[model samples]
Each structure stands twice: as C-alpha cells, then as structure tokens.
Target: MPDYSFLNLSPAEFEVLTRDLLQKELGLHLESFTSGRDGGIDLRHSRSRKREVIVQCKRYTGFASLKANLEQEVEKVKKLKPERYIICTSVGLTPGQKNQLLTLFNPFILAPGDIFGRDDLNNLLSKFPEVERSHFKLWLSSTEILQRILHSKIYNQSAFEEEKIKETVRLFVSNDSFGDGLKLIERHRYLLISGSPGIGKTTLARVISYHYLANGYEDFIFLSGSIDEAYSLYNADRKQLFLFDDFLGKTFLHLKLGRNEDERIIRFIERIAKSDNKLLILTTREYILAQARLSYEVFEKPAIRLANCILDLEGYTKQVRSKILYNHIFFSNLDQAYIENLLEKSSYQRIIAHKNYSPRIIETVLENISTIRPEEFVSKFIGYLDYQDSIWKHVYESQITPFSQLILANLLTAGTPIAMNDLELLIRAFAERFASKYGIVYSQIAFNKAITELENTFIRSSRDSKDKLVIDYANPSIQDFLVTYLNDLQDMMGDVIDTACFFNQLVSFFAYEGPGTPSQRPRRTHLAVTPYLATKLVNRLTQNFVELPSSTLKKRLNSNTEPYYYQVRRSVYNKLNFLRHSNLYTNNIAMRNFTLEFFKLIMIPNHVQSEDIGHYVSLVIYFHNEIPFEEEKILAALAPNIETLSDYHDFKQLEALYTETYAKFISKSAAYKEAVRQMVDWEAENVDTLDIRDFVDDIHAIVDHTKIDLANVIIDLEEKFQERDRDYDPDEIYDHDEDVRSEYRAEEENISDMFDSLK
Candidate 1:
C-alpha cells in the first residue's frame, strides 16, 4: 500500500539512462530529445549513418491503453518533418496486442511485421539454443514446480494511486542523473516517474525534497499528514507551483476530498488561476488508478488548475534500460551481428527476456549479468516476470492446423469448416508444442505457486487436459505471445505476406470457412484490416503495386520510422533509396520509362460485406486509386492481358494477373483522373489511419485507366442504346417535348414521277 517509486530519472538522469539502453540493452546510440518540440521523440539509436531510429517514450501507467492517443499525437509530430519514429512506451504494449498493434503501425516503424512474426519460432531455436523446448513451457507456465518463474503484475491503477509516491524516494534518487541535485531540476518538469515494485519511490522523493530545499526554491515545504495539518503548511510563501507529494487522502474524512482545509487549498488555487501565473505540482498513486481520483482540494485549487496535464510515468523502456546498463551512448562490447542474429534466430526472445526493461529492472538484470549468459540471463528474467508462456509459444510450436472443429491454421491458409476432430488435433498439438518450446523447466515445485498462471497462461486446466485453449490474447500470456511472437513474425516475413496471410486466412476459414476460392483467384491469401491493419496493409500493397523487388525489401523495412505510418498511395512509389532508387519502382529495362507495378500486396482478400471495416475502406480506396483509360491503351503500353474496367468479365479476368503499365496508359481518362485525385486525398487523410490494405474475398479488380472507364461502362452502353433507338424508331415516343409530323406518301410519289418526265 505504498507509492511505487520516487527513484524517477530526471531528463538529465536520462542522459545516463539513454547510454545504458543503447550500449547494454540495444546495439544502438542515444540521441536525446533535447528538442521538446519533438512531441515525445526522446532519442535516436542508430547502428550506422545509413540506419536511423527514433525512440519515443510513453511513460504511462496503463501504457497499452494509451497507444492509440500517443500514436496519433506522435505521428503528427513525425509528419511535421521527415524523421524516423520508433515510439516505445515505458509501459510495454500488452502481449497479444503487440503484433496486432505493430501490424497496424508497420509503416511508421523501420520494419514491417515481416521480421518479427512470433510464428517464426525457428528464430528462437537459433537464439536460445540451450533452451529445451519442452521444459521451457512448463517452467514458464507453472512457477511452483518450474525452475524459474515470471509474474506479470497487471497494474491496478486504483491500488497504485492509493499508495502515493511518498514512500520509495531513494531508488529514484539512485538513477537520478543529476549529481549536485539543485541543477537537476532544470531538465524535466512535471517529472512523473513510475516502475514495478521495489524499483524506487520514497527514496527519489526524499532526494527531490532535498534537491528543491538546497535550490533557490527554499521557501517550498513538504506536507503529508491529516487535512488540517496539511492545510496549515499551505499558508507558507510557496513558489508559483506547490509540490504535493501525496494527493490521495491520508485520512478517511479526506478520502473524497473537496472539503475542509482542502477547501482552503482550492481557494488558494482559485486566486492563482485569476493571476494566470501559478503552478501546482503534485504526486500520488491515486492518480494512477482507474478514474484516477485526484481530489480538487488536494491542491490549493481546483483539479484542472493543478493536475490537468497528466503524465503517467511508466517503468523504463529499452532506451533507458540500455543507458542504465551500459555506461555509453550505444552498445559498447555488445555485438550487433549477435543481436540481429539472435533476433533472427530467437526471433525476439531477448525482447521477451528483457520484458520489463525498466531502468530499475534492467539495472537489476545488469547488476547480475555476471551471474548469467545473455540468453540464460534473459530466460531467467522472462521466467520470473510472469509475462512468459506466451501464446506465440503456442502458435509457433504447435500444429494449429489439426484442430478441425477449432482448427487454428494460418487464418489465410486453405482449409474447410473444422470438425471436432480437427479442432481437437489442433489443440493437442498446440499443447504439445506449447509445453516443449516455451514451458518453464526446473526440478522444483515452482508450479504450485503458478496455479494462477496455468489458468491465465496455459488455458488448459492441467498438463494433460484437452479443453479448448483459445484465449483472448489480452491476458498477459496471450498478449506477451502476440507482442513477442506474432509481431516479431510479422516483421520477419514481408507485410504483404504476413498481414494478408494471417488475417485473410482467419477471415476465410473461421467465419466463412465454407467458401472456396473465387474462380481464378490469385494465389495469395486474404488480409484483415482492423484499424490496426490499415497503415501496414497500405505499405505492403504500395510496394507490391509499385513493383518493388524482393531483394530491396529488407533495406526498406529497416528504415527508422516515427509515429507516422504510411498511407497506401503516399509511400507507394515515394520511398527512395540513397542512390534515389525506390524499392517500389524500377528502371524500365525495355520501355526506358519509370513504372510502378506488382501492387497486389495491398489487395483485400474478401469483398464480404461483414469483413473488417478497414478492409472495406481499403477496397473502396483501391477503386478510388485507379486511373481511367481504355483497355486498348493499357494493352498497347504495358500490354497487360490483365482485366480492365470494361465489363464484369474483364474485371474478373484480372484476378490472378500480375501486370504492369506506364503512367501514360492510365493517365488519359477523366474518370481515371478523378479516381486518382480522390485516392490521393483519401491517402493524405487516412495513410496513418487503420485499414489501408483490404484483402477482399469477393473480387478485387485492379484499378487502372481501363478499369476506371469500365466501372461506369453500363452508363456509356445505355447512352449508346438510347441513341440507336431514337434514330431507328422516329415514330416512337420519347421523353422529349418535341412533336413528330407524318409525311404524305402520295405527294412524294407524284413529285418523283413529274421530275422523271421533265428529264
């Protein structure tokens, strides 16, 4: 029942923290966010001049809940200028949400999900060769019997706010970068630092109190007692901002707040509000809880006048962790090839091991580094964090395909309605592999302490239980899997393939599992576009449409990104290489003009009405992106046999065709012009929004000059038909108001005869 820590790192403190994260944790460099104008872009960690990175820290309590808001805010900052954005929250993303979130934000990151698909368990084997797959799962799931243990403390904001920050001030002091103390206050304001238990709180608070007392602001006073005593201290010649270390009520009567001496505090703030020159600084765990209750009376004024600007200080992220661990800007003795290889091998097991890479925790891990190898150190770390037993471990190790009734194949894979046998088999394999690869292993009774974990992580009741193990990945284990595995896998494989494959496969098999592929459908799988999938799908589709080569894929994926994810059309052919070669574009070897092609990755799988809303938007956008030109022009130029917009048949024929065309071919039509304009406008607005790549299951006709011309072919045909009817049936009544007169046959005949005689 105490505040977590006051051992919060000040901005000056982050200098050392950044160096620690970069050098020890990541093979990166620490570029401070000295420019406060940069939203939350705290630092850049790059291995080489060519490789750039942007580190964003969201030091929030419920960090996951805040991703959407921060993502939007930071993205705006990214677009204000060209800069990489690797936005990280000190409060780590929920496990399962990781992949979904990453896929959703792929364009904004340096890499797509291609490199980090959690499914790529092969990478894990390579990274942690010593980890026996079977024992790992058990140990990870059951801490009592397992050799090691992990405990994901699902932070209750309410409980956190109750304790307040008056307790652990020293730990915060330990990491405080400012040595002399008083000058340290110059860097971070509104400094809100948070972390796990035992990290540091009261210690840092004491240190901060000492700091302000030693500084010029000696008039300030600290108060943490009953309401009357607290209010009396409020009578001092306080600075413009009064620092309230414990805003939560210390007495039962003061709990609800806004009364008694707290009233006096409110009146004081009212006077300050009138001046527009007052500030109120306060701290409390009560501020961390759900509906974080900060009574207006806690401050010498109304709540808004004091704590309106909320900064949820979280534990440390990798950047800060690295700084605390290593004493340098970037990795000193750390090996880049090693980490990348490990990432490629373990596919991000290290990230999982370094789960709570908070400054406090990372410091703990590093302090004991000599006790363990990097892999062992990480394994031990994750085992104890309660973020282990990831569902990714389930998917990667088990044969998800066998569960016919509840079968879990790549949702994009070809499959039929599952039978019970299939579902059972699927779960069985899931269990087996889940235990073998990721289960915790040890010779002790660690499992007994982890009954909760089994219910939370394993899903099954026991080791041999066969009940369905489907879980809402939001649980720490499931979420951890998503973050650690799925996201990692997605980054491992190309986005076009990963996003489209998994989401589409799921869309196809589970809901509409009965339907077969459309006649002549492309070999590729369908993709899903929750708002999370929007921007990423766009990037993949953009590359495919622009005809980026496979070889250049890695280079593009590794580019440092800011919060700004790519819009389908903006970065479609826009990304340029150092030599100005674009991954999505190629030199026209034959025609000698630049061209964009292979834009299929962006296609949505199903046109189902009930599919992902983002996908539907993507389908519509794809239509909007098309240019109107006749099929003949396209044929003559790139001469794609692919379907054009003329009729349903031509459109249908384009299903499997991978074709290319010059801009000239599609630039001729007014309709094409409109579609392109609308698409650009839409991309401008929604690029970073969700659902740029919609893989429709129904049918997707490539948008081209001919296609734009064809979308309205029926209108043209009907017009021609009306013209023919009017010319042939002159006697027929039409919508026109004009009258028709009949001719006299006898008069015309006589005139002809007379003319002949005269001749």
Candidate 2:
C-alpha cells in the first residue's frame, strides 16, 4: 500500500480526491459546489425527489481544527435537513472523537461511519486503487516515492532539486501527452519529445521519467553532455532510464553537434532500441528538431521519425488548461486577495481561453506576484498573458537590477554551462571595460552580490560531471530573452565582443550566410550584424587569431589531455568555419591574410589528428582559388593518417571532394584509394563489434567506391536479428493504452466539476 500524505495536496485537490473516492465507494454521482461560501453543502446526490445525501469535507491536519470548523457547519446542515449527512476530514478521528461529533449533529450524523476521517480515506484508497492512481499528485507526492526519486544517482545534475521535483509533481496536470509518451517509449524503447518553447517539453519528459522511476527502474540518468556519455554510463544488466534534454543544441546546432554527432546520436538510439533494459527520453524544440533534420541527413531516418512525440497547445483541451491554471493558483503563494481577484467574475476563463495561454507564462507570472502591486495585479497579469513574448522581457526589465542584468548579459555572451571561474573573469573584464557606462561600481563584493541575486532566477550554478562549478541560464527562456534583448541593442555588441574572454563567444553571436546553414534562425541566438558591426567583429577575430595568448600556447604545447586538446581544436574549428562560410573572410583581404597566417601557425602536420584532418581539407578546398598552400604538404599530411580514417563521414567528405571539386588533386591520389580500401577491410574484419546501423551506410559507400563484397558480414547481421526476434516476449512489455484512455476519460469528466468548485 502506498503511504500518501494528503497534506501534499492543496485543500482543493483534497476535496476533489474525496469526491472521487466517495463517488466510487457509494455508487452515486455527487454534484460538487464552489469552494467559498458553500452554504453547508460541499457535495450532494439526490436519493429521491424530496431528499438528498449531503457531504461536508474539511481538510485539516489536526482534530481540534476539524472539530471547530465542523461545529460552525452544524447549523447549516441542520437547516438543510438532508436525508443523510456525511462528514469527511483529513484529520484522523478516534472513536471517542467520532462520538463527540455525532452528538453535535444528532440525527444528521446517523452513524459513526458517516464521519470519515484520515484513516477511512486511506482505507477507501486501498480498496479503489484506480482512484488512487487517477490522483497523480496524491501518489507521486508520497514521501517514499519522493525520497526514492531524490536519492537516485541522476540528481547530481543539479536541475533536479528535492523541492523543485515535489513542486513540479504538485502543479503538473496530466494531459494526453503523458499517456502518449508512455506508449511511445514502451513500444520504441526511446522517445523524442519535441514542442514549441514554453509548451512543457522538459516537464513532460521529467514526468515520464518519474513514472518509470516509481515503477521499477533502478536509475534515472540525465545525459547532460554528448550521446557518448550515455554509452559510457550504460549498464546492460541494470534497468536504467536516460534523459537527454534539448538533445539538439538548445540555442544553435553548431554549438551542440560536432562532426558526425547526428550519426552518433542515431546509432545511440539504435543501441537503446536493441536493449531490453534501457529507455531513452529526449526533448528538443520542434523547430530545432526540424532544423537538425534539414541540416543532417542522418536524422531523416525512419526510426527518428517514429520516435517523435510532439506536444502542441491543441493537446491541451479547455478542461486540461483549466486544471493547469487551477493547480498553479492553488499551489501558489499568492495572497488571498489576489486569489479572490482571480476567482472573481470567472476572470480565469479569460486567461485559459486567451490566445497566448502557456504554462510557462502562467508559472512566471505567479512566481513573481510579490513584485506586482496588489491593485494592478489583475490587469498586469492579464496584460502579460496578452503579450506572451514580453513575459520574460517584463521580468528582465522590471524585476532584475542592472548589475544582475549585466551579469546575465555576460553569461549569455559567454555561452552556457561555463565554468564559474571563467564567468567571473568575463564579468570582471566587462566591468573593467564598461562599468561607468552602466553606472555601476566594480568589485568582487558587487559581483558576488549580483550572482547571489540571480541564482535559480536568471542563472543557475551547478557542478557538472567533473564536479566543476558551472553556470547556465535558469531556463532556455532566459537565454531567449537575452538574445532578443542583445540583438536589439546593437550598440552593446562591440562592447560584448571587446570584453569577451575567449574568441568562441564572438563567433557564437553571428551567423554567416551560406549554403547548408539553417534557413531558420540558428538555435544559438545570433545577432543581426550590420556591415559596421561585422567589420568590427572580423577585426576582433583577426587580432585574436594573430596574437594567440602565450599562456594558451603554452597549455596547448604542454597538455595532451583530451579535454584541453578538444577545447582548443573546437575553438579553432569554429573560427575557421566562421571565416570559410561567412563573408567576413571572403570580402576582407587583410582578414584573409591573417587567417592564412593563423592556419600556418596552428595546422601542423604532426599535431593534426584524423578527426581534425577533414577540417583542414575542407578549409583548403573552400579557399583553393585564393590562398596557396603546398599540395605536397597536404598529401604528406594525408598519407600517414590514411589508416586512421575509419569514420564513414570522413570517407564521404573525401568522396564528395573527389567527385565534384578541385580537391580531386588530393582524393584521386594512390594514397586516398588505398585509405578507402584499408578502412573497408578493417570494418569487414571487425563487423561483429560495429553497430549495423552505422556500418550499413558505410557498406553501401564501400560497395559503390571499391566494389567490396560484404556477404559474410550481412549474414552475420541477419543472424543477430533472428536471435533478437526469437528472444522477444510480448508478455514482458507493459501496455499503457487502457490506462491512458481511462485516465483521459476520468480527467475529462472531473475537470469541469473541479474548476466549478473554485468559483
């Protein structure tokens, strides 16, 4: 039996739970009354034309409080003179206390069973488990479940706090998505939840994860980094559930996915699909997913298409929207005056029925209610709903201080999940450069004060897998707000660029116009750079590239660690790609000279790895007409690394260059053909260890390029599939179709009555 503390629910939720349980226990469809001034009636069912059975529900934690509240209700009950009166209280009542209550109501009480207390409610829940499950908040908030959820190893991600999880469960109103998500995950062993911003994609993912956790899953793994992290942490014997929130980069695709990341993610999904003990849940903005599919051909696979669960506002029915609003208001810390104002005139209907109704907007407004003047609360609240885009704008402009705002600006410019130390360095750098313009004094004390104010509001500080303190926006909306804010204030772009601690920040702010770039805006918000701003940005990049910091150079030379190496490599790649794709490099002669000089300085043959070789080849190919580099040196770099070119993507790039560009000078060489044959042979030998999904395309490419026969490898893959099919069991799978349909029907029937009780 689940030990549920009804105290976790608001009085309104408690009332609804009581009504549902009693309706099940007594076989009567009771009509519920509005919460305030009930006139001695909470719920009533007509037994005949002349009389009705009446129920009075009091949600109190103590017997004394329950008795005192019921004493005031006695006279109202007497005047109505119902056929039978039943009293229900959350406070546990002893036999003596029940008798004492029976004396006060006399004939109205009729029997001790008529006075239902806390224990009786629990007993009813045990008997009617369906009712217990229907009230998600009631069971999810149980102390045992919350303890289990919080104690899971996955909570180290810092996004999942104890109070936050509890509050999320309390306020979450189930909709069709919950059931749909369950069926999808159960059937596919993976789910990709996509939706518009603020439509509760992450919330739905967390809810589904919690459901599996409460069932029998051993761990809830949060994939905070690349899909490789999932592969690293996967335990074949353990029933581990994994979540990758905003799997496609949150702000932009370039920042999120690296070379072949799309392929890597698809392969990881296939791996999860084959595993019986694993479940993967991913969430991304709908536009981001669309952009990914357009940018990366690998994402267009049928598996990815089947795994998508798109959450739309249409899925939120009027009743579902009402319950969402009612839950937020009921659990909110708003003063009674504000609550009354919302309840007055059924004003909540306007909000629910508004064109721009969003759960995020509602949560943001309610969260900052203390900042709004009581007199203007109603108008301002409705105003925010009217202008949904301005919800964060209002908060950013009015609620936060200018110092905190600067902190957010620099944090945004610096990019997300930046080290706390690095952000402090950038903040101090910004203050040193432009403190007087913003009318603020710069000090360690001031910086600390600003960060303290913004924590969990504008920004959140969390330790990553490495246990390094890093900061990211509290939510994506903050990043969204900051991007729009910064772009509109182009005057600050120069200052932002000048004060940036690293060159990558400058690159993140602008998108270049070229083929293969997203037709839609990049997820990473980019500023609309004018010609003047573009020139200024180009100059900064040139200066940074030409005069590489001595300390950074020393680190690059001294450290061989993968992280440091990759950091430098990624920064260099972003700069080169920006120049190659953007007009900044094409139109500016001086910028081109500086870029070539920088390339000569860093693109050493011995230092270049196989993974990075393609970057150099693509860069050289793009600038083949303008810049001159030795063909012999390029071939020299390619020859020794031929055997290491194992990734199919590398071969695809070479093939493209060979088939359609000036780079055939390198790709049509003896060394290139030998490299292709070696890679195909290596794969054929190690086929059993490789994922078939990854190698299937590779095999096709091999057959096209080298006419390599892989009959034995294909036979091996077929046998593996046959073995998997033989082991499959329909009885082992849990079907949520019936449960979901029942839950929807129950919610649909009760939602109207539940909101009516709030009037």
Task: Identify the candidate with maximal lDDT.
Answer: 2
lDDT of 1 at 223: 33
Evaluate model 2: give its TM-score.
0.84
Q: Give TM per candidate.
A: 0.23, 0.84
Candidate 2 structure quality by residue, lDDT tens digits, 1-759: 555658767666677889999999999999876565778888899868458899998878898888888889888987899988999888888999999999999988889998888889999999999898878778777877777877666722546777888888888877787877777787678888887778788888888888788777887877654665676566667988999998775434334465566777888887777667789998887777777777777877775564354445346788778878888876675677776677666677788888777889889888888788766766777898777657778877887788888888777665776667777887888889898998878888988888888888888876533445667678876776677777777777778777777765665546533333332244345655556676777777776763422111101111221121113434464367556654445455556677776776655445455665667677766656665656555555555465443433543454443454325544456665566567656765554333544565666756665554565655766676566557666565544355444333324434434544553
Q: How many residue pairs clash in all the candidates, one count each?
A: 146, 4
Residue 231 of model 1, lDDT score = 31
Worst 10 residues of 1 by lDDT: 550-559
* lDDT by residue (tens digit), candidate 1, 641-717: 22221222333333233234334445454544454434333333432111122211111334443344333433433
Location of the lowest summed lDDT over 10 successive residues in candidate 2? 549-558
Clashing pairs in model 2? 251-523, 251-524, 252-523, 252-524
